[model samples]
Target: MGRQNRSRKRRDEMNKIKKARYDAKELIRLKKTLGLLDAEGNEIMKDIADVVDIKTAKEIKRDAKTREQQELIYEHQESLEKGQKVKVTNDKTGVEHVFNSKTLKDQYGNYPAWFKKKKTAKRLRKKQHSQTKNFKQAWTTVNVPL
Candidate 1:
């Protein structure tokens, strides 16, 4: 009786692994058939679950981390556009860098010194004020009877 129980448990384990592998294959096929992935993405996804092995788990974890980093970068771009300060702290070096209009790197590895803090509005207002000051208006004093 004991031998039979052990053999049954081993069989169950084998069946579980088979089902898991089949499920992974079916899911990949569905993604491809449904047109849910672009050509490049489909190619990448095809290899995502090549085998239900230990490596698949590691690949999934790495992909998650990469996706999270991408989201952070996008948020930083939006904040920079709105003239907000962005700070970056490197993990290995533990160095903190503050970015502003005066110092910030963009997608093309170019630093734009004039990306923010634009003074055009203030300069225009100053010019208009100066022009108004130069114009002299004549005012005549009139006595009003109450």
Candidate 2:
């Protein structure tokens, strides 16, 4: 097969794999809703235990993080409305740049270096996919080297 055809074939296979996983998760959820399986996907027996929904520590932390981010966004909006200037310090030159609300939207210098280099959704997805065993197996099937 040509290079383009091979790539396309691999992409289709990956999509199929992803769809299968999604379908499997959906099926498990359906079974749980029907009371056939527990919340953890284990078989439910009247003798064993009742199904329960509990939040893990990770979920609690994630919720807190989202709340914090929302608060920050609100603060930023309020500051902007009050015509407050954003101050950003350059790491190299140690110079502070105060940006007005109008300039903040159009200028990137007012943001920190880490914020400026923040990964996009697509890039984050690609990075995560590359780390998965499925991605490795798919690439190998295409006769491509890691």
Candidate 3:
């Protein structure tokens, strides 16, 4: 077979293997639900478990990249604490850039204009008339028939 055909055959075989595993798991679940799980099903499950696991190329690459990013971020944080130049990496582009912790205060300086202390809205209470008068005096001044 040609290279392309061989690769396609491999992919199809992988899909079939994945489907078979899924079907086995589903079967086990269904049997358990019906209280019919038996030694045969358990044996099949053990056989499936014994199969060697395969990690995809993309996932392996992603794990390598993540470890590298974590190292970069740690270095950056360490430098900031020691007041040194920090080598920071752009997560998306995987590009590294250096910045002096002492010199960089962001574009808006150390504190932005909008960075004031948070103040909550003042709640206005309902107005009570003649607030200065004592409770007894207030009633005495009010008009009432004997």
Name the runs in model 1 displaced over 4 angstroms: 1-3, 38-146
Which scores better on TM-score, 1 or 2? 2
| Candidates' C-alpha lDDT | 0.54, 0.58, 0.50
Residue-pair clashes per prediction, in order, are: 0, 0, 0
- lDDT-best of 1 and 2: 2
What value of lDDT does candidate 1 attain over all alpha carbons?
0.54
Please tell me which predicted candidate would have the highest lDDT against the true structure.
2
lDDT of 2 by residue, 1-146 (tens): 54678889899999999999999989888777768886667976653235455689999877776765555445444544655577767788997777665434314444444443345444334334444555332222123332
Q: Can you give the lDDT of residue 78 in candidate 1?
A: 50
Model 2, position 64, has a per-residue lDDT of 75
Give, for candidate 1, the lowest lDDT window spanning 10 residues. 137-146
Error of 2 at 107 (Å): 78
Candidate 2 weakest lDDT stretch, 10 residues: 137-146
- Give a tens-digit lDDT track for model 1, residues 1-146: 34668889999999999999999889877776655566565553344445334457879877776765554445444544645467666588796655554235643444444544354554333333323534222211121111
Tell me the tens digit of each residue's lDDT in model 3 across 11-112: 999999999999998988876655465655553243433444668999987777676555544544454464456665658878565655644433324422
Evaluate model 3: give its lDDT.
0.50
| Candidate number with the higher lDDT (1 or 3) | 1
